[model samples]
Target chain A: MDTAFCPTCQVIQPTTGNVDYFRLFSLQFSFSLAVEQLEENYQSLQRQFHPDRFASRSATERRLSLEHVTRINQAYQTIRDPLLRSEYLLERLGYRVADPGQSEPQDPAFLMEVMEQREALEAVDLSAAGAAQQLGRMREETERCLEQDEAQLARLFASCLPAEAGREAVCAPELRQQIVRVNHRLRYHRRFLEALDQAEENISEQGV
Target chain B: MAYNERVLDHYENPRNVGSLDKNDPQVGTGMVGAPACGDVMKLQIRVDDQGVISEAKFKTFGCGSAIASSSLVTEWLKGKSLDEALLIKNQQVAEELALPPVKIHCSVLAEDAIKTAVADYRQKQKSMG
Candidate 1:
């Protein structure tokens, strides 16, 4: 309903800027998304707003089609990624994650654990036997942590969003804090994955 | 983003890139992370008998900006009293490096590391006395 289409005039319309990404894709507001369906919707929207389709149309209509396509692409990109989706939903619900340097005091114990794990990773000798397998196992462990973070986020979002349609979404402060915490862990896991990729590259380079 | 010359200098030739023994009574270690950028920094300082920071060391797992921030601070920490070290601000580090708004957080992380390490040292001192 919030797309570039008039009900009766059959002409492209403009967005009101209030339309969230979920509404752009005509989906419900939730962390649990059907990614395959989202991809299908994305393809259909891209086709519908293809610039070539507006070549013979009015200049205004052509511009509107381009704008629609750009917005659609952005919405798809944001909603498709689990971490980005969580952040978007949290922002929409009035929860701003702590800014750098102003963040709540983290648990020193947790920080020490992460530091130790990083140290362990750095110590892995790729030249040693079974180092590749060791790296693979570590990657798996990090991925499992990421999945658990996502699952926790899904449950938190479910509880935070309003149950009834047309009613305002009520964001509980406690739940908001929990979501922020999980989001931090998700970021850490994602970064760890990048580090693992770097290690994998090192192993390959050595093999060559 | 292209880093400024000062940032690049610190990042490329990062000073005191190592770790001090955390168990040492005179050594204070600070480990901090910025989840937004997925950066982790560890900064440590060893106090001499005169209660001045005689040495500083750091190991950072982050971008050039983050590394530069910690590196620059480690250079500053040496020879400063704990009170003087505490006075060092993130804004000063940001200004010194000419960091962009996004990477200003890197300087902030460095500032946090300093404060944390100072606090840790104080805590250890209090417990021992």
Candidate 2:
């Protein structure tokens, strides 16, 4: 039902492969990004590659726009979040939390901490009124831990990534270890936050 | 969102939801978590002299699928010998629950919990002997 896009998006730029998400969105290839600017760029790219602009074109051109639009959305999601972006960068630099695939996370100490938190959450009194009091305090604890993980992420990223060029050059073993630790820590906090949300839902479902 | 009837029944009235004494020599405790979802399950089994599971208990902090999975396992564990219990597999539990593909992990966790609890019991037996 359409055709005639402007010259700006005549072709998808990274057709060859290994498209760095940060660079795809006109941002430096680093852990930190101006999230607002990233969102702005995402919208602009989506507009540029809007499928409606390609319907009247050849079949291949139409299909490419569809594919490119999906890629743009994926890149936008990866680049916009601090946690996901850190994991992405760490993987790009060859840091793997599970080396042989599907193995449990190797850090026993961290999992022990996760276990304790879960235990504490489950032990809370489920009585409606008490649940609120317990969950509120639990929320503060989880939020505080989440914030600390985020601060660690920021610190690691700030140290590992320069303001300009050559992300590969910065992947020293020490930095890789730091990134992996931060990534694991970040996952723990993210998962805890998710659990806290589920707990709150269950409590409120009981009208607590 | 159409859960299997068996799964719903189990979730609504989870069987054997509690703790067993960790200090008891006959009680083997298995605690596990899935980092992907932050689901934690603690399953305990009391083994008699013949290695038959005398009683089973569990406390799970997770979704309905996980709760159903653990409850189903505890029910299966009672009266089964430790050797017989080893034959249990995640696929069987998944099929029994008619769990959707995404919730198959719950079944896997259930299977893992069984093996872990039994292993803990055996280890204690060996230590005391």
Candidate 3:
């Protein structure tokens, strides 16, 4: 049987066995991950398992170092981003939700809202005296929306993984719907920020 | 690292970068972004009543890879049926643009924008009906 060796303990752990990555790392599935905590974990892992650190080891130890490094990188990438972590959880549950580039259905009213926001951004004239002020208001509104969405995501994560309950309530359909809404709002906020950046660039270029 | 030169060329001179009137019933707008990189892309396609993409345009605020990805998709989506356009994948975009492994997500974002924009349009049509 294929096994993964832990770089820290030098223990050969079976990959096919029951070793939950999230559980091992003591991370909850939520948008509230502290970046500093993640960074600390990554640094610790790098110190222990990075290939350069294992250069003087035997051939098997070197192979294990590479494998651990790959897993550490993959875990870091997933845990660092809220959206990716949510998507990873969904995928782990056997949901075949396509990435944003896939042809999944989206809500129409949400799209309409996106269009309206785009129009509002385009209409703001940076040449005007209050254009920057207006754009700032828009940016504030977008940031508020993002904060609200993140709060909702925290609630969703709690509901899906209630500490009182066991793993039985993990994959509810409502949680899936909530995830989709978070994804949509996240997309909108990103667009608004981009528009804001473009407006600022234009203002600077014109010496406004 | 210097990105693939071809990818850089497309990014710097992104073809079909602009916008269509979203208020137009025939136009569908797909807005997508990566929060991690703070990159945002807006893609719009004008579809005829027959559901064929008559025109495509985009406005992307991102790194060179993202701009190139959306620009390439707009050119690829135009004149194709929505169904055919949905079939476009990140791998194809990455392969055509020769994106490095690290930048492959840029193509993925572009591919998503196309599907999303088309889906947004179809939803509008359904509500109207």
Candidate 4:
């Protein structure tokens, strides 16, 4: 029974989605990261489990390699973007963000502000140079919003993580509430970026 | 997944595609957003003194399924008594629309909109009294 095959060794590493991404990447579990080091580690891991390296290994070993590679890719994706990283951190802290069941409330005044921005974005003349400027402006505003949220997220996580590094992050009710609000607003930032990208693509396709 | 003809038909020719004056005493407004997909829906109904819904309107910024769901509910709400409206479940909307599993959230949103609208109306009536 060849039941003890691991991609790295005889030890089976935890799966990416289920485990802490920092642990998955063999990095310290903090919001701040040395991106170059992350990239280097990712490349090294990918090279080690590149499937070709496991072609002559046992079938179980090959399967394990594939699983590791899938997890590695997923972890990389989750950690690559600040918004996604913040979401992942919040998730690890046991909040589902905007889960339908939990349905957290957002500030109505803030929502009205976002809606007005959307209306302005909708009215942009994509055929004109002003379109690019308009999109850029909105994108900047969204990025600013994201940056502010990320700062808040980092502060919240920093406060919680140091006290309980060995166990699940001990989330205060205030932290939970803040995380939910930030996560909800993060959707708007993401939507703005997506909309901007689509508009830009259509404009480029039309050569306008 | 490819939308079936009925879903597409509803999407293309949506019913009650407008807004109600939310400030109006007779009107009840339910505005909901699905944080999962970032879809927002606004559903409104005008209830008569006898508690019958006489008019319904909806405006939704979402996928075709969500739009169709809101549209279908508006049509259903027009002739429904408040009690009947309260009883209309999301499953009924899903069944009527032939919504696939992935689109079930849209139906849920529709049902929620109805309940919220009723709740809003009741609150307004209470405050008035």
**Quick one: best TM-score, which candidate?**
1
The candidate, 1 or 3, that scores higher on DockQ is 1
Q: Between 1 and 2, whose lDDT is larger?
A: 1
- Candidate 4: global Cα-lDDT? 0.78
After superposition, the stretches of candidate 4 with alpha carbons farther than 4 Å from their true spots are A1-18, A55-59, A97-114, A125-129, A163-165, A205-208, B48-51
Q: Write the per-residue lDDT of candidate 1 for residues B3-43, one digit (tens) a residue.
A: 89999999889999998999999999898888776778999
- Chain A TM-score for candidate 1 is 0.89
Indicate whether candidate 1 or candidate 4 has the larger lDDT.
Answer: 1
lDDT of each: 0.87, 0.77, 0.74, 0.78
Residue-level lDDT for A163 in candidate 1: 57
lDDT string, candidate 2, B56-86, tens digits: 9988877899999999999999999999998
TM-score of each: 0.93, 0.73, 0.56, 0.83
Error of 4 at A82 (Å): 3.0
| DockQ of predicted candidate 1 | 0.56
Model 1 chain A: weakest 10-residue lDDT segment is A96-105
Candidate 2 residues lying further than 4 Å off, grouped into runs, are A1-18, A34-40, A43-70, A90-101, A106-116, A123-133, A152-185, A198-208, B126-129
DockQ of candidate model 3:
0.12
Model 3 clash pairs are A100-B112, A101-B112
Local distance difference test, candidate 1: 0.87
Which consecutive 10 residues in model 2 chain A have the weakest lDDT in total?
Answer: A97-106
DockQ list for all candidates: 0.56, 0.20, 0.12, 0.35
Q: Per-residue alpha-carbon lDDT of model 3 for B8-127, expressed as tens digits? A: 788778899788988887899888765445466789999997889989998876689998899898888978999999999999999998988778878988888887888889898888
